[model samples]
Target chain A: MSCVTPSWSVAMKKNQLRVNEFGLIERFFRPLAVNNPGSASLQDDCATLSVKKGYQAIYSMDTMVEGIHFFKDDPADLIAKKLLRVNLSDLAASGGHPRGYLLALCLPHGFPLKWLENFSAGLQDDQTKFNVSLVGGDTTSSNGPITLSITAIGEIPKGRVIRRAGAMVGDDIFVSGCIGDAAIALKLFEEIGRAKTLKHYPSLYNRYILPEPRIGLGKLLAGTATACIDISDGLYADLNHICLASKVGAKIEMGAIPLSICATNIIEKNKDYWESVYGGGDDYELLFTANKDQRNVIENFASILNISISKVGCIQSGKGISILDQFGHVVPVRSFGWQHF
Target chain B: MSCVTPSWSVAMKKNQLRVNEFGLIERFFRPLAVNNPGSASLQDDCATLSVKKGYQAIYSMDTMVEGIHFFKDDPADLIAKKLLRVNLSDLAASGGHPRGYLLALCLPHGFPLKWLENFSAGLQDDQTKFNVSLVGGDTTSSNGPITLSITAIGEIPKGRVIRRAGAMVGDDIFVSGCIGDAAIALKLFEEIGRAKTLKHYPSLYNRYILPEPRIGLGKLLAGTATACIDISDGLYADLNHICLASKVGAKIEMGAIPLSICATNIIEKNKDYWESVYGGGDDYELLFTANKDQRNVIENFASILNISISKVGCIQSGKGISILDQFGHVVPVRSFGWQHF
Candidate 1:
């Protein structure tokens, strides 16, 4: 009864205007419209969205340029999934449920249509896994890198959503999933120059290529966590956002930080890579704060989500993040977050 | 008191992560969030949206690339407005009222910050004119041409939304405002190559730079018109979209198609430019259909809106379009829509 996004079936039928684009949508994206009724098979220029009675719509947009966000030689499917996941991570941090998204891609002139097949397939996989749908989007050609922008829309109960501005002093800080694996993958990628196989630690390569969004964990943290953010800009940098917003300080211990076996092994051999743990980003994990009373609930959340949830630090009375070592001595922070490509 | 976007004042205080980007938002974009409660001043990664009863949220996205959608040297402010207006035009076609929007900018590396001030000023002006607010978005640097993507959101009464599939045979095809001016400007741009002032017909140049979205007219037509669309691709191509969606044919006399004084003068000097009038795009006007009995009402809509509404053709029970010359012979079509960069 309500109109949302009419799918591409309307425009693609003509195939006389922007023939390649219509064809691309028809063959690749039209199938991804299964989640919502307003998709009308991508026939209309605009799609309609509606919110439920107790919920409000949540949105975030992230742009990823080839070579800046991912290597050009990466699998098209992984590239598409990573782009979607990063935006989803933001919504998760807000404790919203996955819903639908809009994607805009600017490709180099004469972009191969085959790449879209792989790209949309990646979207197909994630849309199924996350139980979301492709509501609307468009694509165009340029001389620039393959540029991707996705506006992710979700929903959260009006009363349950968390924010970055609610942390209180003495609140325990928790991070979901492992931290430095993706950052290490970036380093490995630069060293190997897009080798089809990473000569070692394929899990590190996998984590880099595909990130698992902490959507379930994030939703569980809602109402319980006082403040929350996603770890896209490295742990310290993203946590600093919490401190600045909540007008508090934080003390996170390096020993309490969760790490994958591969990451730990690499760090044991070379201390220089510690900077990656502290400053390198692309984690796509949830970072949040809750009072000491919520510690047991958070531990239960970790078990329920089947992902590691570490007590990295606690909110302090002052300002900024203090990165303490195993000996409780402050470790000099090397870097913060994304430096432009 | 419902938490929406917790503006950038929170994360921007640190100024250590993505410093250039945070500074850009603080200087230019933070000023444009005047229209919505959810726009927490561009600080948070995501914003929340709520829809009112009896309405459904309408959404559409448009992406523009330098050298593809517009010239690289075009004024940054005009470029920004056009990008926003184009997406707004899509929403207007669906009979949606202006609401809030998200923007994603992929700028060339070392993009001058001053250009952003001009660009944001353009958005500020239009956001005020349209009474919409900036909700959320992100920007990243790339080596590619300037790429801007906008997702415009609006609201339309559930029962009154117009769709392209609803037009029936015998419906009178109508277009709002003059059609050929922007197309003429495109051709003139090719001939002049970035001249500051047009030696002739500055109106055409102006139309190409900034398009007026018929948002108000679209809302008025929602319940009265059978179907509607905005002309972004030339009128012929866009009309063909309606025909394809509605499963109908169209017959329009070239002489009946409205043209601006400047466009008429150009066509008089050289008939070769007729193709530009017929197939050239970038005109953000509404084209719709109504049954014969509604002619008087359509005329009233025109007068009420203070814009000319011309009946160019009638929908027939078939497919495709027939463009008739002054002598009633069918004019052969050259192109229908956008080609790549």
Candidate 2:
């Protein structure tokens, strides 16, 4: 194959080439220099970082593809922020603080300049807010979906990083906030014409576009809770992740789930909305397990942290996740959870 | 669009899958337990890793795509090793010791099993060689290329991590090992059917498939070298990285460049082979700069490290890279170094 000459001048004319991934990276990240506490220089062929003595670094990676993770025209700015935020949420679930990130971007032909500008702006915004830097990344052209792969590096205070397998039988299960808003927002956005007939909930849309990562709550629960996971793959599936890792099962009470009034209203209006709550994805909330003895402590801590904490279920020595109805009997779920496979 | 019901088993197969944009990430990575260091009984909701005082952490990531980076049927085992080794080479370039890594894989439908087994065996080989572990990662199905994204975390003594911006004018430029063998090997590999006459150079082929990372040399140079970089995108482009980062220019003498006997033989047989050395990608060697006074020290150290070091160039005050022929006249390069863009 011949090496295609990318028209940087024409791309610049359209404002797409203002900051090729490398240019923006050089502008914002170059000044940080190397050797700051936890500093990974942007110039090295690679970054050098030290894991704390007696502590191992916690690492994770996620890739978001256009037309799969988000719509192709979903405001390039929002897409960039959401990409970083989702990875940050993963770090929060594991009780790891953002240290640095690596980005791999695959650009399709004729990538727009304004999109790159707005996308970089979004990246800069989140990086400033989160105090994370774009350390290094690769930029390549592809004939397929524009894919962004982010690997987030974080440090946990020695022995404080949470994992999925720490939950014990009988631990009280709690979720940090209302669930399913993102999925609801997705539906609403997909059917904007019908949104006028339904109640307008900008918060739901905001939840979908820019969900808050519960980094503080994660750090707060790091020392106290037994097991935790972020709700990226729907409640049931994410909760099952905790069970699988912790070697326990869970029984969640339907009535106890903290559904927002908007979610409740939506569900009442469309019976199928229950599927969104029970099986929808991309909520970015934290679900965790804690001992019953720590209930009062958790409540006080939650108040101090100013994040909602709701009891949704209890862990049991079993093999699968189950739900309870108002009658306190097992209710067969219509779906297990969202599966990427 | 419907949530496509992917055949999990078929998608997970190894050999049936061909390499494309997303490399062989999905077939190998399995979700594993998070072994947090701090909390005993590993019951904490989050892993709490205690950061040691006065020590900073280093992080880096790189993604290799099929066709864009490597070919599809390029020894599945070697492909796996190259993926990890290249990232480790990045860490080495920055003077960091490997700690662990997170992998994100995108696999096409109907991958094979034996391929995965061989790939994992290769990973096992490198894991033992480098003393690193697979920490965490994500796996998904894609309709595009097989892609592998690896984020490696490493540690350097506090304030000792190296950067490319520190090179001073007059600093001697040094590169480990003979350059261009990997590129020549690639060229020869591609012309295998027509160039049956050039089949004797197995060393060249090995260089292309498994370029050894100079980790120990990078570590040794960390304290002495003013700046460093890895030669992945050939010498010119990578040297430009150091120049741009350090705000300096460089002059390389063609005579000083170290060429392997296999590379020289190929060049003698085909004059065009010189282009491969100057413009080839995927040579995971380290290129660094140090003060002229340290030349003897570096020379002695190279012998001690058991690695060949060639003084190929010198840093100068200016803006770009230039090459000189034997008589000291400037020789125009035929191409800018290889670029993914």
TM-score of candidate 1 against the unseen true structure:
0.93
- Candidate 1 ranges beyond 4 A from true positions: A1-19, B1-19
Question: Candidate 2: which docking quality band?
Answer: acceptable
Candidate 1, lDDT over the whole model: 0.80
lDDT of 2 by residue, B186-275 (tens): 677666631352357777767767878788887787789998888887888788888988999999998898999878877888988887
What candidate 2 gets wrong by more than 4 Å, as runs, is A1-21, A27-41, A48-57, A185-203, B1-55, B188-201
Give the C-alpha miss distance for residue B310 in model 1, angstroms. 0.5
lDDT of 1 by residue, A225-281 (tens): 999998887888888888887899999999998998889998898887788776777
Compared with the true structure, what per-residue lDDT tens digits does model 1 show for residues B71-138?
76778899889988999898899899978899988876546666787899899888888888889888
TM for every model, in the order presented, reads 0.93, 0.87
